[model samples]
Target: MSTQFLKLVQATRVPPLMGPKKRAASTAEHASPLGAYLLDARAISPGNLAKALALQLREDARLGDILIANGWVTERDLMMALSAQYGIGFADTALPPHDLDMIRSVPWELCLQYTVVPWSQTGGMLILATSNPDKIPQIRAALPPGLGNVLFTLAPEVEVLKAIALGHGKALARRAEAKVPERMSCRNWATSLSSLVVPTLCIVLIFNLLFHTTMTLAVLSLLACALLISNVIFKGTALWFHLTEDKSEFHSHRDHGSQTKRPIISLFVPLFKEPRIAGPLVQRMARLDYPRELLDICLIVEEHDIETRMALARAAIPSWFRVIVVPDGTPRTKPRAMNYALNFARGSIVGVYDAEDAPEARQLHAVANRFAIAPKKVVCLQGRLDYYNPRQNWVSRCFTIEYATWFRLFLPAIKRMGLAVPLGGTTLFFRRDVLRELGGWDAHNVTEDADLGIRLARLGYETEMVDITTHEEANAATWPWVKQRSRWNKGYFMTWVVHNRQPIQLLRDLGLRKWLGFHMMFLGMILNAALAPLLWSTVVVAFGMHHPIMTLLPEWAVWPMALVFTLATVLTITLALVACRASHLRFLRLWVPLTLPYFQLTTLSTYKALFETVRKPFYWDKTEHGAFGGAEHDVQTPEAAGIERKPVIFGTPIKDTAPNIQALPDQLTKVPVIKVGTDGTIRRIS
Candidate 1:
């Protein structure tokens, strides 16, 4: 049945002319006469053609792409028309059988890059199939010399993709599994774990044996205090900068011309075991204020995650949205899934979002405009992330205040100081080329975003913080929050290890100042969390409670240590309060004093993180989403919550108009059938 289907599909293809070389299109062909052909065939209305033509002028895009983007014409129809116009044969419904020899002639990366694959050989000519005709010339230029005669056929992108997946999915998946270079990856840590550990443990043991136990304890205490003080000072500086930053620059960004031609932005929302959020995810994405025609959203799911695939199939997926099934591979991390799905993305600017994200309406527009005006070296923009369910519980309120502190104050200060900005997993946009050049992300690194940010700095690219905010579901429960925080801390440890593998080289790449900042950020964060209890113990002295550490510290050291502890406490509270105020989360202000106790939870997470770093470093501790009823259960809009309209970034926060999400009958009775098989293939089964 498959062979017969292939044969029938092949029959529609018009093979390129029989020649050693095909002639280039005539001057008239560049004028996009395909629109007239579509009109004559009645494939698209006259008004649709005019609209696409107008967009073509502004976007400088292909008429067929514009038409297809608008959903004015089916992709198959566009390919058929292009086939007629160019005299290239159309590869219908399913692609013909692959020629392993011909496929081997081209590099796997090149095939994915151009969206073309070798189909079969006939009459001393190799027939190549492609979804994108514009890439043909580039493919031709890249082909090996001995592959003498070649012809091209136009196929619908879905068919071409299926062919590629069936033929090379394993090889591509393996490559994606380890895109980061070996020295830069912590994937092989299992081998070197002992080598990296034994020496450090031996030195500490030797020191303990040489010195008296009390002296060793005193020394450790002093070192921990020094690290704590330095980390606190850094946080203080960042907070001070945030308080005094000139608002005029942000004001200018708001008033900057919006006439810049907007590019198609692609977003990858990686989902694993997130079935519950699929419908809500679609509804949230639909609220984006960008042109539907230009939005390309790929909801990526692991091959084994049937629940998510089923959930997505049951939803009314917009034409602009695509469901990408990631082939199964090791590590099974979000970055790995994104690395595989990146091949299928169709935009020059790629962003990432999580399953439960609900970005402000104009966020994409803000991103496009900022990218338009930003310098070429500014390759990344990290947006602010907040929570919509901050009022859910004590955990959520504390989470909100912590996020406000990080995004509003800490990140902005880091960017201002020319330090590497550790990227948050979501609400991040990057230049596709630079992202690809950096090898996407370290699949084995649990905190791929933070690792990538350091890599960006090492490569001399800059990351700027944009004021745009994306509201998401905060982990409102206790144990779940610990698991999530542990995963993040574990990633930080791995990132620090990978980057510092070659300290002098990293120092040269990041420079002296940034090198220090990097240490303070990663090492300091690790220390602060891991040694938080050390400082917390000092607080007992204020309560006049007897503490064991008093025996180790001299009388002179006691007063200074107490003073430093007090200073750090004040700085932390002050920073959190300022960030909370800046976020306009006035109701959470009363919770600021309790944050010290709140952060003790992180100390527990730090132990778990340490244990996991040695045992399951690559494991992605999945955070469950849609745990709290959000937009559907709460007041519909931000205004309804009594939130004032103000520029958090560049524009007023838009109202959250809920999407029409009536559940469909079982088996997706009323919806178009978008089937993702266990092998990770998407088949439109209408």
Candidate 2:
């Protein structure tokens, strides 16, 4: 069935031509015109031709389109007939060496709008390939006045489209290349100094001043306390908003009524390595409950990643899935690959998913419904993200708790308060037009998602949180987890620096409330991670070991210092539990007592991140997956890992755990079976 449909679609785009002897005989036999020639040549039957002519009279489409739609004549046959009748040559798909110069002669927009490509220029004539050769006058009119005589040649519609994508893609790539440092790279002197050099100098200066003056030590202590107080207040406010906000406004179920029509949705999955996960990724995507014809999935692979490319080739992928090979370039990152694929997206809505993501089956439908009901100013919808392998190790469990806090509590709270929401990397959907207007993702930015979210707010576009989840693999090992966290921390630092480049303008763009939120979220988070160890070390030494550092400070400062530590600890623990409850990971709340140690891990990653930012700023520290657990248990599925999927109502989980099963081909779907016990714990049904 797939083969037959593909044949028909291809036929309409580029028809198969007959042998030269047969073509000449038909042409010589029938000199009436294109339609009569096709009919006489038996390229199209009398019934199809008659039906096409009748439909052409009522519609604005060309006769060839109608004929092809009705399966009467192939686009190749039509183009051949038209070429013979008009006494023009059929353009070759092989791009010429002079193509670049010709492309520069025409505006990119005009070329795209007209479906015409400048083929070559010779002497006084500028040659062009267009399926609609009859529109030569209009095409010429759209071109700039400096060009000489315009010549038209026939080409298959597919070839013309290919040419357009190629030509426009090259132009976009050139533009992207020029802006690489500004957009993605952190090699600039300002970023380097801020991320590394300044921090080092500040630390050295603080220690020197501490040895020389008690006033300097007092000032440093007060500054640290100020940052701590601001961090606690930010968390407290977000927690209050999370608890007090009306949850009924955010619907978990899809609005079926709003989905009057299924719009094409383009899903981009950028893969680098991990051949082991390819089969699973394909199966997961295949389970998406969307009309096959309306789902455009692009598995973007780097041109050099042969292992992943081969793995995808071996997978039982559906015909609708497209593999886009990103060209080799600098700042090779996921965002760069996605930017390349953006040009080929055919959907009105575009979504990004990681290679390991397993988004809900109806995620796209829900996103579409939201888009339908939303105002034009709402350009992006960020879905919740959690780890499927949370119980795989202590690191993963802590990571999951952290994610639960950010995605379930903090992000939703910000969205509710009408503040800028820093977008998570995966499970994010955008309006195609708006995304293009914003120039897609910054190829050079490490945390393009967060950067884009801030950019959207600066440009007066709003992002809302959708009540859906995409399960991803947690970094289970300590080193890998540290690497992953370091990248994230580095990205946060970069995002802060990039957005804060024009502080006055940013302050004007985002009002005072939002501007403060942005600072607390990005810069404050960095400070928290970097300074937590220092504060913890001081407390351990002064209180735990009864050290003399406490004697250096004034007597009045001791009470306030103890109060800040107590308050911060209490607020963090309370918020962690709240986040767990909100995300249906209440069982993980047991790990709250270990939060201090968990944060210490983050401190390690933060310092590593700081160093990397100065040394290899744009380097992507790839996280390896598929290692699910430690010695206690082997690798397992989500169910085997004891994770449950539950719905949240009014920030509370209802005790129901029946999996929403959607049947698909065995080779294309692999949902793990889960069972919920009376104690509210989830276990594998096997």
Which has the greatest lDDT? 1
Q: Per-residue alpha-carbon lDDT of model 1 for 1-686, expressed as tens digits?
A: 12222222232333332122322331222223465446545687644554454455455346776777657798767866676556677654544656565576766777778888877666767777787786788889998788897888777666676667767777777888888998898888888753265347548857895866666655556667889889778987898788789867664543565545567789999999988888878877766766655678999998999999999999888777888888888989999999988777778899999888988877877787788898999999999998888888899999999999899889989988889889999999999988888889888888999999999999999998876899888888889999999999988877888788889999999999899999998878887787666666667766876555677666567788888888888999989888888546988999989778889899889889878877788888999888776535332343444445321212322222312212221312233233322322223344
Q: Against the hidden reference, what TM-scores do the models get?
A: 0.85, 0.73
625 Cα displacement, candidate 2 (Å)? 3.9
lDDT of each: 0.75, 0.70
The digit string of per-residue lDDT tens for model 2 on 577-674 reads 98888546978999987766877888888889888767777889887655562111232343544444322221122333222312111212222333
- Give me the displacement of residue 273 in model 1, in angstroms: 0.8
Task: Report the lDDT of model 2 for residue 532.
Answer: 68
Judged by whole-model lDDT over C-alpha atoms, candidate 2 comes out at 0.70
Give me the runs in candidate 2 sitting further than 4 Å from their true place.
1-109, 112-140, 144-171, 178-219, 259-262, 540-553, 582-584, 627-686
Q: At residue 1, what lDDT does model 1 achieve?
A: 12
Off by over 4 Å in 1: 1-30, 94-106, 120-126, 134-137, 145-148, 193-195, 202-211, 258-260, 540-554, 582-584, 630-686
